[model samples]
Target chain A: AQTVTQSQPEMSVQEAETVTLSCTYDTSESDYYLFWYKQPPSRQMILVIRQEAYKQQNATENRFSVNFQKAAKSFSLKISDSQLGDAAMYFCAYRSPLRDDKIIFGKGTRLHILP
Target chain B: GAGVSQSPSNKVTEKGKDVELRCDPISGHTALYWYRQRLGQGLEFLIYFQGNSAPDKSGLPSDRFSAERTGESVSTLTIQRTQQEDSAVYLCASSSSQGSANSPLHFGNGTRLTVT
Candidate 1:
């Protein structure tokens, strides 16, 4: 079984600043996928960024990037130039490369953007 | 629809009653998933269906919860003798292909179920 952990329950960042949300997972599989999902008050899950375990280079999507340390079993999400729209509940997820492709999610961290 | 669609955006039912939640995945998507989200918590995988493959119900919390997907289209999650703890938001998602690490999931707004 794979378990994702987000130590921070809540986080706040000032507008236009940068913020990093930590995530760690325990998985025995050598090949897998890591993802960060954002859910606003609307309760819609949106993909933020994703990282492949086999890739040494981190994944970057515009202002959202990920720091993936496979050896340490750590995958963190970084949001640069944070805006009010970035305020949401962020979740770290783990998915197997196998056929099942079921995602296991962390408890989540509520992000707040301050003006 | 252009995206994943879940029916009955909100449902209220009495405890011990059976409820069914529907999900309409994006057209041409081969993978569909069901997840449960409790208040202020992350999503928990409930079931998954990949094309014609047998569905994975390993994540289901109890035998009372069951789900079925017809081919690559609509899916329904049924909870029998629902309990108060079953109250939560049920989310449905679909992906373009199976076992594609780069494919991101498209999610629906989710059905908020309240069992009183």
Candidate 2:
């Protein structure tokens, strides 16, 4: 079984500043994929960024990026120049394509961007 | 639909009744998922189907909860004898990896099920 953990229940950052949301997972598989998802009040889950366990280069999507530590089993998401739009519930996820291809999501962190 | 579509945006049913929620995944998407999101809680996975095949179903909350997909197209989740605990938003998603192993799931707006 695999599980994802997001220890921070809530976090706040000032506008134009950067924020990082921490996440960790437990899986025996060596190769897998990790992701960050954002859900606003509209109730739509949007993909934020993704990181491949085999890729040490880390994944960056504009202001969104991930710091994936395979050995440490940690995958954290960083949002640069945070804006009001970045205020939402962020979730960390783990996916094992080789095993069952099922994606597991963490408890989630509520991010608040202050103006 | 261009994106993952779910029917009955909001459903208010009485307790002990049955409710059926529908989800239409994106075209050509073979992986479908059902999840329950309670207020202030993370997404709790209910079921997953790959091309109409569900390998593991132990994630379902109870025997009253059931889900099925039709050939990678539409999926329906049925909850019998609904309880107050079942009053939450039911979300559906579909994924396609294409040639790579890393794929992002496209999510629907979700159906908010309320059991009164």
Best by lDDT: 2
Every model: iRMSD: 1.3, 1.6
Per-residue CA lDDT of model 1 for B6-76, tens digit only, reads 99899999999999999999999988899999999888888888874545677889999988878779999
Task: Report the error of model 2 at residue A65, Å.
Answer: 1.3
What local lDDT score does residue B73 receive in model 2, on the 0 to 100 scale?
A: 89
Chain B TM (all candidates): 0.95, 0.96
The CA lDDT at A12 in model 2 is 98
lDDT of 2 at B115: 94
Report the C-alpha lDDT of model 2 over A83-104, residue by residue, as the tens digit. Answer: 9999999999998877444689
Give the alpha carbon lDDT tens digit for every residue of B7-116 in model 2: 89999999999999999999998888899999999999889888898889998999999999876789999999999999999999998747435878899999999999
lDDT of 1 by residue, A1-115 (tens): 8889999999999999999999999999999888999999999999998898999999999999999999999999999999999999999988887745567889999999999
Candidate 1: clashing pairs of residues: none
Q: Indicate the worst ten consecutive residues by lDDT in candidate 2 chain A.
A: A94-103
